[model samples]
Target: MTAPFPPSRPSPTTLIGGHVLVAGGLATGGLKYAADIEAEVVQVFVTNPRGWALTDGKPSEDTALRESPLPVFIHTPYLVNVGSPNAEVLEKSLGSIRHALRRGVEVGALGVVVHTGSSVTQSREDALRQIHDHLLPVLDEIPDDGPDLLLEPMAGQANMLCATVQDLGPYLETLEFHPRANVCLDTCHAFAAGHDLAAPGGVKAMMDALHAIAPGRLKLLHANDSKDPCGSGRDRHENIGAGLIGAAAFGELLGHPAAAGIPLCIETPGKVEGHRNDILLLKRLRDELA
Candidate 1:
């Protein structure tokens, strides 16, 4: 163990990470499964792995999970496309959002993460309208104790509206989502989407942009590296500091003015050793760069 936490005063939380406990993808018991497999905390999909209709999970099941100091998070199903223009897709998307919020409560999760999907060639105004119309209502249904939602912008690919974090600005502004409606910036997605967070001022620029939109709404970070060039619009996630985005970028990310104390989650390849290596690397950066 990393020595009983060293008993220091808790610092103010920000975008950077501090001893992150990456949640494993749901292959079995969802969050409980990850918890059992040596996860400090975990994130899981509470539904049919690849379906629109979310499965109704029981709350008592979450109550029976193994005890730990780590907090759990829920990742909404990938089938949800909140930015879709088709009526059927739109309805399903909205329903999926509601289901994710509700399921998050059942599992005693900290929050749920939703991808800021594209508008599918629909007018930009209409796309924004759809988000304001369908998404905000789900946020309203959530009670104070319910798990809040975290909006994640995807890599900007052809036909996708939200390819960068900046693309989510309008959606965030239009929604009545809880104050906890935070951002989850994926390193690979952000880098591939456009923002180069590896240069000297790159991290500063990213922090500035993130702060400009939500101020303090950045909740979690999908700590990953990219395999393509900057602005490639590819979503390939490589091991930390090993791909297109160099190690210095992470140094900037882990040691940024804005990124100081957030739960940096790892969604990289491999399970035990992959996560272990990344976590140790991040910890080393925090120590050397912080």
Candidate 2:
């Protein structure tokens, strides 16, 4: 029998989880993977993350996830770039997102994460316009009960349309501040984008900035450590506590008021064992504060 689902809204306490690769499928392998890691929440890709091929979930797997006690989330394929200048790339990106959203609803996901894309070969203004024109209709079509569209800002890579927490202001305004358009702050990305999460009171300061810029829109957090230095613009992720963003900073992150009810999912390295250790550390940090 499937387990009961978690609460629809944010919980009073934070939930910790990792991105589970369901190579054996959600019901058969994914659920077991989550259990192995002792995850309180879960994130999965509904299709090939690096490819444009759209695949459907198994009915059994869908039902199992829909009823699972853990709150579920979907990370749209990496190929999705709604801000692309090329028409074909743009079309495929939108199609991939729509598919992810539909599958997210099928699996009772609470949020769907998509990267804030870059403005390749075009001015940032033109790219934002493209995103506004094409992506708004897609956002409008989401059902009331469907998962939220969580826009994760990128590391401050060259030409990225959205990198820092402040960049979200313009992006959301371009979307006319749609109710479904929410934020998913990634620690590694934020640090790489120059948030200085490793410094004293850095996490709290970043959280304060986020709340000021986009109040009540932070629905998810990607707790990751950077393999590169601050402001490096690199996206390489290292295992928790082993990289630049140190374990202490994560404790601060857990204690931040703005992060109290948010669910944090690690996208760090070291598969199952690494994820298990990371989750345990985060839980310990959270418990100590509690």
Candidate 3:
């Protein structure tokens, strides 16, 4: 189905923002929260991030976000695991994705971020086949004007379907590389998955690998620092400069050609002040590189 409202594509510049809290609603609270952090782009969850229940967001809040100048993206619930071996889990995952996509159109969101899930108790081949069977139809239903389904590879956790940039090759292949099948590169996840973004040239190498794996598929970035060491397989997030990924790596990320024009949204720790500082630091890095 065609998206009733197609979001405008973001310009070719590094737009920095954070995942703003929406406890106060998107308009009454979320927009102000983003403003206080001076966010240039925004990521939000239309429904509870951890719950399976879908919500019809307040019309005023939806309208507020749709009309707002900043680019918007929606992150699906953490429970969504399309690659799961359980039938009930797979069904719920697909439903959640559809809900997020619908809400993305309602809010003029550019993309809907969904984690590349695990394949618990099943072989990798079986999980991929299941994903292809279920996910392809969802992708096929998304209209050209609808939000892109941005698959976020996780930290190198056990049984993860996609973690490294190279892994995205098969994952995208499973989805047939649909136009709307894009990627969201999270720095901490990449570091945990053993990309070593903190090392010299590491960020560039990762970007190069992504380009080689799925050219032009990167649509969003989660600019975060890893609380654990590279290859730790931990998903802990830290303030930009305070973690293992470090601030300099972000500078390299901003300078990289592949990252240009993509919106960078911080999922780092600390609510307001921490996010504000992270955004400022990234902006500084982006400016210095420019």
* lDDT against true structure, model 3: 0.90
Q: List the lowest-lDDT window of 10 residues for candidate 2.
A: 1-10
User: Mind giving the per-residue lDDT tens digits that candidate 2 earns over 258-282?
Assistant: 7768999998888788899998988
Error of 1 at 169 (Å): 2.2
Regions of candidate 2 where Cα sits further than 4 Å from its true position: 1-12
Which pairs clash (backbone N, Cα, C closer than 3 Å) in model 3?
none
When 1 and 2 are scored with lDDT, the better candidate is 2
Report lDDT (Cα) of residue 100, candidate 3: 96
Model 1 lDDT per residue over 11-73, tens place:
333222222232442323444434333444556566664788667654455564323355666
Please give the TM-score that candidate 3 achieves against the real structure. Answer: 0.95
TM-score of each: 0.84, 0.95, 0.95
Report, for all candidates in order, the number of backbone clashes: 3, 0, 0
Candidate 3 regions with alpha-carbon error over 4 angstroms? 1-13
What is candidate 3's lDDT per residue for 1-290, written digit by digit as tens?
A: 21121233223357899899987887668889999999999999888888899889888888999999999999999999988989899999999999999999888999999999999989999999999999989988887778999999999899999999989999999988888899999999999999989889999899888987887889999999988999998999999999988889998888777777888999988889989999999999888865
Residue 239, model 1: Cα distance from true site in angstroms? 0.9
Which stretch of 10 consecutive residues in model 1 shows the poorest summed lDDT?
1-10
